[model samples]
Target: MIYRMLAINIDGTLLQSNGKLHKSTKEAIDYVQQKGIYVTLVTSRSFPSAKKLAKALKIDTKLITHRGAYIANEIGRPTHSSRIKEHITYDLVRLLEGFPCQIRLVHEQFSLANKYKLNHKLLSKTVFTTGDPIVYSQQFVDSIGDTIADEPAHPLSIEVYFEYKEDLKDVQEAIGKMYHEVECIALNDLRLDIVPTGVSKLTGLLYLAERLGIKRNQIVCIGDEMDDIEMIQACGLGVAMGNAPFEVKRAADWITRSQNLHGVAYVVKEHFRKQPQIEFLQKLNIIK
Candidate 1:
């Protein structure tokens, strides 16, 4: 079948383990855009970080960011947003402070974290850059609660990092019981992302698809994480990287080489080469 849109995840799918984009990946993306295909970055990262990578690749398509809570175009104007409520944010911060985890409030314009925990390696990866820090750089606050009190309208989601499995489970359970409208997703073994109910990469993608007039079967999604599962399942062609977890690979229609091997370039090259014929058949309703 013909594919019109390519939704790619960032962390594991695009960036290598060293957190750098492959040269071939950029070439492949440019190749697809040359073929008249729409390629978008669907990630759990904040807009600033995502935008930084997209600019590096010279990608101009709309971005699905904040774990599907927000979608914005090349200029960073949000086309849609699903934000967490103020009361719920207050409740979450209060409940999480009791645990030993570090909490970060993610917003469209800026992010806020505790002053003491901003130096964590992973968190720093998101907040600081090699030279100039992007827009999503985290601001260390003395108290997250007070930051929320000062500017409650800016939050899009909450990110929590735990050192122990027990604390993670406890926080997950507490969130489940207290806020039915909130959803907690374990981005990895140690990181948990909290967004509003019904928000996901697929949700944001669907909105963008409707606006662009693209169909489900005409889209290809490539990802390598639990949060990527939904879009991987929903898109017409789902691709998983070789380094993806067992479950993610199982959910995909195909698996490519690992990130370091330039898997994204491989997929785009192989698929778009035959796209003309596929597009012909699809338009004729000869292949569903």
Candidate 2:
């Protein structure tokens, strides 16, 4: 089948484990855009961070950021957004403060984070490296509640990082019971993103697909985390990195090399080489 678009997850699929984009990955993206294929980053990263990476790749395609809560190619102009109400955001921040976790109020313009301290250093949980720090840095405040009250926050989503596994579970349960309109999504074992009930990367990609006139089977989604599973399953060719968890690999249509091995570059080079033949359109239900 002819794939018309590629949706990439920024963290594990696009960037290597060292948190850097490989030269080959950059070239591969450039190559796809040259082929008239739409490329977008469907990530949980905030807009500034996602925008930073997109700019590096030299692609102006719209980005799906904030765990699918917001989508836009530019700041202050969103084609779609499902932001948590300021009041809900306030309440969620208050709820998160009770646990020993770091909380970030994510928005397109700025990010507000609390000064929560974890006694033990959790792996990769303490640092917010999803985006370029210099481009979109967090302003640490003693009390996020107070800061938001001073100027009400318009957050697309709230990110929580935990030191204890039990705390993560507890917060999930509490948020589940306290807010039915919002949902807690586990991006990993220690980090969770709270977004509107129906928002997800899959929903975000679907919106982009419809806007771009692309079908489900014409899209290729590559991701390596739990949050990526939905988009991976819903797209035409689901690709999982070699370093992805077994479950993620199982749910994917194919597995490529790990992040360090230039997984994304490999997929683009192999799959996008073929153009859909006219006869295959009938078999793919595209010409019925």
Candidate 3:
């Protein structure tokens, strides 16, 4: 089938190891755009963080962010936002009481705990692909204190990250028992994202689809992680990168090459090329 729109995840899928968009990938996107296909990016990163990437791709379509809790256009304007209920946030804060881990409260960017110590290395590593860690750190310090606090007035989203998966699961289970109002998703072995219920990449994509007057089956989703699973499965076509987790691969409709190996470009070419053949066959009334 020829899809009218394509939604691709940024990290771990479209970006290379050096955190740069491959020249081939950019060209492929331009090629598809010239052919009249719409390309959009769906990511967990905040608007500020996603801006530069959106600019690079010349995307003016809506962006899915905060793990689907928020959806906005290329200009960082919000189309929709889902916040965890006040009571749920209160419960979550209590649930994390005394837990030995780092928690980031995400509004648009990351807000760390007031007393939180700087893990300079980890911070640098995390933002290395996105932006300057030192600059981000300064912003965090300037906005919210070093230690994260439970401010009912704020009513923001939260991401709990642990150094170990075992601990993260334990915390996940602990919070899961108390509140059915939130969603807990593991992005990787090291990160767990907790957001309001019904908030996911799928939700964000659906919102965009509605705005664009496109049906679910007319969209293609691509990603390389478990968090992308919902979106990939929901789309008419789901593409998993070779480096994606086993579960993600299994959930996808098709598997592509590894991210570092031009996997995105390869799959895009395949999809675009098939369109012409289908059109040609339709013209001949062959199998129509």
Candidate 4:
């Protein structure tokens, strides 16, 4: 059937291997928009990061960011948020104090421990950037400090990045057992994310659906990572990219080709083309 909205993940799902959107993907999205189906981006990146992609797509739709801890519009206006409790935040900071791995705190953005150190460089590369580490790190820390100290309210979300895959799992398990109120998800082999319980891409999509007056059965979600698990399963048509892990593929209702091959475009076109036929048959109660 014709879906009312489409929720697509950013990193591996939309952008190509080089972190650029393929021409075919953009054209397919344009085609769907012209058909009056709302397209929204669901991602783990912060609003600032996700903004660039949204702008590139010419999307005026809502964004789910910080792994679904925060939801905002294209212009970065908060529509909903779920934050780690203050006590839990302090505990997390304490837990990371002596870890061997690099620690970066994310509050709408990322901040490394040292402004002018190798840690910052490592983090930027791991997170998809080649900018000056000193400048970026200082700016990030300053932003976080200001938010924590001056803002009347605490940040709505926080994320800590680890360098190694093994370290990430250890930290995830430790945090999971320590704090019963938080949710920890390992994004990939190299990254781990923690958010408040019940806050996820699915939660963000539901919030958006409520605002748009659309039902769950009228949505389609596509992704290729662990964070996308909940969203894909919840959507009426849950799709996993061909490059997605075995578990992710198993969780999906359908698996499209690899991202490098314009997988997203293929899936969108297939759904868009088939939706009309399904709707027409249903209208006549052909099989129902």
Q: Give a tens-digit lDDT track for model 3, residues 99-203.
A: 655556666544444334435456326542222343233233332321334345233367665655687788888878877888787766556678888887888
lDDT by residue (54-93, candidate 1, tens digit) is 9999898889988788899743478888888898898788
Q: Order the candidates by TM-score, highest first — what do you get?
A: 2, 1, 3, 4
Writing each residue's lDDT as its tens digit, candidate 2 over 69-187 gives 88999988999998788888888888878777888887776788888776665644466754567877678899898888888876778888888889888889988988888898886
Per-model C-alpha lDDT, please?
A: 0.82, 0.86, 0.71, 0.72
**Which pairs of residues collide in model 4?**
none
Stretches of candidate 1 off by over 4 Å are 74-76, 117-132, 277-288
lDDT at residue 177 of model 2 (Cα atoms)? 84
Q: Which pairs of residues collide in candidate 1? A: none
The TM-score leader among the candidates is 2
What shift in Å separates residue 87 of candidate 3 from its native position after superposition?
Answer: 4.6
Where is model 3 more than 4 Å wrong at Cα? 74-76, 114-156, 163-167, 188-190, 274-288
Q: For model 4, state the Cα shift of residue 49 in Å.
A: 1.4
lDDT, model 1 = 0.82
What would the per-residue lDDT of candidate 4 be over residues 1-288, giving only the tens digit for each residue? Answer: 558788999888998888789999999888887766789888877676777778888888878877777788743458887776766665675576445444445555443332322253455565433122432332334233334444332344444556556777888888877788887766556555667888878888898898888788889899998778888888899999998999899999999988899999999878886554434545688522
